[model samples]
Target: MTASTPGGRRVRIALQLQPQHAEYRQIRDTVLRAEDLGVDVIFNWDHFFPLHGDPDGKHFECWTMLGAWAEQTERVEIGALVTCNSYRNPELLADMARTVDHMSGGRLILGIGAGWFQKDYDQFGYEFGTPGRRIARLAADLPRIRARLAAGNPAPTRDIPILVGGGGERKTLRVVAEHADIWHSFSDLETLRRKSAILDEHGAAIGRDTARAVERSVAPHGEPEQAGEALVAAGATLLAIGVSGPDHDLTRLARWIAWRDAQG
Candidate 1:
């Protein structure tokens, strides 16, 4: 179902539990704590190496941690913030998501993107293709991923929502308009409004009603509560905030949760 209700577009808060510079125990604990505090979704980035601080510091794999999150929490939706499409075969990824869907009793959101990060490719031996090539690959693979999800033996417990993360006006937004259940981005209010219009045009050309087909998502962490309020005003219903590890601070997370509760 859409995250909206009769009252208004529901304000969803997701915590991107960055899987670096911490013990697995710490990450697990943060997941539990975020759930306990009533975060709507829990996300972890997919990467082989750390995204910040000490390039060679501790890091964790994405999907494996998601499987654990599927088992650990009962209420919150768990997923990669946005999985890199180049990392795994689409069919295998579908099966993996299906397994996690069952494990979490259908509390899973499949967030995928065309892979970036050259280091992930260099160290892992994946080809760091041109941006166009990567986008083209993503455009081709999304259909296969959807088909596999449908064809799986057990199938996903529900129509697992596909959250496509990007804001490219040309190819990415077109793919999002055509297939995504959620459109996620880092754009601010005016940019979101402008690109959302492009998304609408793309949707119209494809005979899809983007307004109902996709929910807007934003990571409004720079100013937590205020940024979140502004983003919601700008048509973003899902606000994800990034929280780094080790100590796993919840100060800003708490502020957003408070703001979300206040909205209701």
Candidate 2:
């Protein structure tokens, strides 16, 4: 597929409603509101435990939440900010994603990664292999996932956009170049620039259109006007602002929404 212009492409904003320390009802309510407030995407993290706050805080599984979101929201793409690829079989994950894609009428994005949280590994009994090994597994599994998605009974509503989240200069980026429709990272400007160039180099090995093929994605910092412009200049157009649960404040998200609306 041909790539779209990086900076010139439509700017999109995503909200990562970290599924921790909140009731499922509360999270569901917030998901509904975020969509009405005009977010382009709504994401949850793929972790078995809370990433911060209470170590044993209330947390929900990622894909299940996405499945629910697929039914609940009429608009807004739903996915994990990045799903940990270590947890489920690539074929199973592919089937799950395809099911949700159909459920949402094609509003699904399969965000995935080589997982890093050791607690999820330890408690869930998944091996806490070295980072390189985990990345290698991710690279190896992606093709299987693609094949499974293709082979599934009832094809997906559309080619599901696989979003890969990582910054490793070698393995991770290479995987991103090969499979990711969107490449995500939590990098500052310099890091975004540097690692993006590295991704381009890797993409070149596969004839990836660094400027057009893979969309750049990142978190927002500071004011939306300033942060959004800076990230876009650095080649990131997806501004995903993360928020915690319980209150699940939308102050930042609202501001970003206004910022995105103001862009038009």
Q: Which 10-residue span in candidate 1 carries the lowest summed lDDT?
A: 1-10
Distance from true position, residue 248, model 1, in Å?
1.0
Residue-wise C-alpha lDDT for candidate 2, range 114-168, written one tens digit per residue: 9999999999999999999999999999999999999988999999999999999
Clashes of 1: 0
RMSD of 1: 2.2
lDDT of 1 by residue, 193-239 (tens): 89988999999999999976789898884665457656776678888
RMSD of each: 2.2, 2.6
The best candidate in terms of TM-score: 2
